[model samples]
Target: MAFREMFSKNHRTTDAAPPASTETGRDDTSFYDLKHKIHGRLIEETNLAALDSMDPAEIKTEVGGVVEYFLQEEQALLNEEEKRQLIVEVLNELMGLGPIEPFLKDPTISDILCNTYKDIFVERFGLLEKTSARFIDNAHLMNIIDRIISRVGRRIDESSPMVDARLPDGSRVNAIIPPLAIDGPILSIRRFAVNPLKMQDLVNYRTLTPQIAEFLAGCVKAKLNIMISGGTGAGKTTLLNILSGFIPANERIVTIEDSAELQMQQPHVVRLETRPASIEGTGTVTQRDLVRNSLRMRPDRIIIGEVRGAESFDMLQAMNTGHEGSLTTIHANTPRDSLTRLESMILMTGTNLPESAMRFMLSSALDLIIQSTRLTDGTRKVTAISEVVGMEGEVITLQDIFVFEKKGVDKDGKVLGRFMATGIRPKFADRLELAGIEVPEDLFSIDRYYE
Candidate 1:
């Protein structure tokens, strides 16, 4: 027998039923069996031939009709309460998509925003476009949110109705409901590329050129403390992952993230993810908690997936104190903004450090900042490669070793720019020499840039 046919008769519907309804008088094993039976029977009885002809919504409606037929056939065996519960179960199975499909299938969409049941928006190429994909209603949306958070061992309700989770595909999910959201349910999904984009692939997309790629590789090889900066959908994490490829395959790496999206190709990579508190408000693992813990693991390179909040302070401390060649990303518009953002995050640690002290720490901890931007033409590109040159009094000083100079726009509305080098050789090059990596002195000559 086929798989669906086998499940139709022998499988228990209990597994598919809602948790609330599972408590009903029905036996879970029997209910699970009936559900699979109904699903198989519904598909058989319906116009399976015409399935391709119908829209997804219409197909769902027709499937609902089959469910009603199955319920009527079993009406004599079930009481009124059991029958009512079955109706809800059938509808949920037919109408609700498990919370993982939209994120995996969408190639162009970078982010999925769910403000409420009625509002859904997805960011495609830097523009937010409304989508027809939606839940059955607010209640249905809440059910999915419940199912998802429950699997991750998180919680959501009136009292603690906000949650952060990762779908099976590693897409980051943030959800807020009821009192906290006030707009029914709010869910934001930051989609991850199921297949991580590699550096060569990014170059094929015109995101960066080969020369800049070699330079970034050199920076990674030289153990330059590098931070990637960008706005939402600006490809900061993607660039970070690609840059991480330059690390020698022999070195041990520790990657820390809230959701664990970085796909480092190194064989010795240790992945650490943060944990959420249980329903009773116990067993929480914050990013700060993980960063501090990763320190003891003796990573050749410690990479915090993204530095936000107090974790920035610990990450900066790690880079300054023996963790060279460390990597992290930040949300900012420009390289300077990235430094300011780091300062703000460091202060979030509640250190109460003076502004000058924070600036000094940032300047000393960071060696290079690669800033990326999503241009008006709907493409994200690396715009500047800057070197941190220590602090001047109250201000952190930086020199752009390489910058993207946009000459002009093409007729097709694409922005054209060249990543040119500056004469300033990074202070860490001497250390790279000891590692048997030789970057020609002329590679950093500003006059030779764009030649």
Candidate 2:
């Protein structure tokens, strides 16, 4: 059945129908039918291989001409505005992400999620809303997915039903097809901002106060090792990028990630990305390998994008040896949980180090943990700035330098809270002073919140 016909029977009174459905009933039905007819004709008439080699502008012009000719030939009833829109949609189908192109262009949309051919959702302001966009069918969605993965030198089929890739614009994409995906092919795209979020931008969004930001900048300047901890989508990587900006421009920094996402403006920076196994299941490079190799590159600082496994051990070793001002992120809810996660990841290396020794290593290496959280209201906040003082026996001790205390949610469900200093001065104050980074004395005043 045609897309319009599939929904035609369910239509109530014209006034009750959604604006899109009502619009479709009025003229969109004819538009889709005309679009379908023109698409078939174009497929049969155009030289797709030759068209691929032509410049994009030329291809668009040729396609536009064909669309105009088809409209005239078929005597399709379309107004000027409808014809223009149809042209754009047809061109998008030919060269872009089709139905999802508009969402990709929407700067406010942070994520595009496709659960099935007809079920499409977009996340805006941390809330998911169903979109009017959809695929024609399962086969149509799979074709788009195949095209996306193929561009990145990857493939997904029965042999390989799952793949992770990125768009040309650096948005992270993950797709899983059946039999792995029982519901249908699943595609999730985490869009990257065209203008990367800076520290001031984050402050404006109330992710962290300026005082904590200044403290973090000072820690980075003083060559302290920092780990950002958070759950998925909690803005951990974003904070890592902002903190990295504090590094001196003259220092050489090395960044390693599974997929390169960090946009560092530093002139002396080296970025490394891991490689997935080839079709023959050979020549895969893991993050652990990158971390181990970064040591010999004589980097003044090393930034692991995130320590998911054995790489955590190597990252700690780098910190314990000589590399300071190093930064990384991990998946955890709290500062303490971050340490536990690190300990678990270190064991994945098969190091067989005693628990006491591992705790001691963690305590010695990590100077601070900045815990980020996405609260119920969908606002991300840096909930804790914890200093890893040292090992108290087998336990790694931590003291909060700053914390976000929740009062209550307002009537509109907005979270009401304040970021307050813990009054306890950080052990690194002396070190920071020695490094010529002067933090204000009143910044740590008891119960005081930086307005």
Reference-based lDDT, residue 276, model 2? 85
Clashing pairs for model 2 are none
The Cα local distance difference test for each model comes to: 0.77, 0.85
Residue-wise C-alpha lDDT for candidate 1, range 1-451, written one tens digit per residue: 2222222443334444323322333443365456656655654544455555667666555665555545545432456675555555554554444333544477877888887877788888767888765555688678777776776777888778778887776778899987877769988888888888888987887778776777788779988899999998788988998999899999999999988788888899999998877777889889999989999998899998888888999988999899999999999999999988888777777798888888888999999999998887888888888989997878888998878788778998878777677777877777768777767768788876451
What number of backbone clashes does candidate 1 have, counting pairs of residues 3 or more apart or in separate chains? 8
Best by TM-score: 2
Off by over 4 Å in 2: 1-37, 48-61, 72-75
* Per-model TM-score versus the true fold: 0.77, 0.90
RMSD of each: 9.7, 7.7
